[model samples]
Target: MENKYQFETERLGFRQWKEEDKIPFAKMNANTKVMKYFPNILSREQSDEFDS
Candidate 1:
């Protein structure tokens, strides 16, 4: 069956966001280098809110 949550290739896969993704997403958002172009890194609450 086709998976609505996923898109894949030979070496890579992307999927719909899940609750599990929040932690990692928050961590990535917390990175200063990554947020450098933005005004500031987002808080977990803010990230989760924006993510939805």
Candidate 2:
């Protein structure tokens, strides 16, 4: 039988997190404007550890 569950996107693909996404995720966290509401911008290490 074919799989019953599937996920799709228009411009991007979706999948479980992998080790490769660490850098981009960290960049987002390190961005001051993105984190303006928070007390401070996240460090690379912090961003690496943070979950979506």
Question: What does the lDDT read for residue 26 in candidate 1?
Answer: 91
RMSD of 1: 2.4
Model 1, global lDDT: 0.86
Error of 2 at 45 (Å): 0.9
RMSD of each: 2.4, 4.3
Score residue 47 of candidate 2 by CA lDDT.
83
lDDT of 2 by residue, 20-51 (tens): 88988888788988988999888888887655
Q: What value does the lDDT take at residue 42 in candidate 2?
A: 82
TM-score of each: 0.70, 0.59
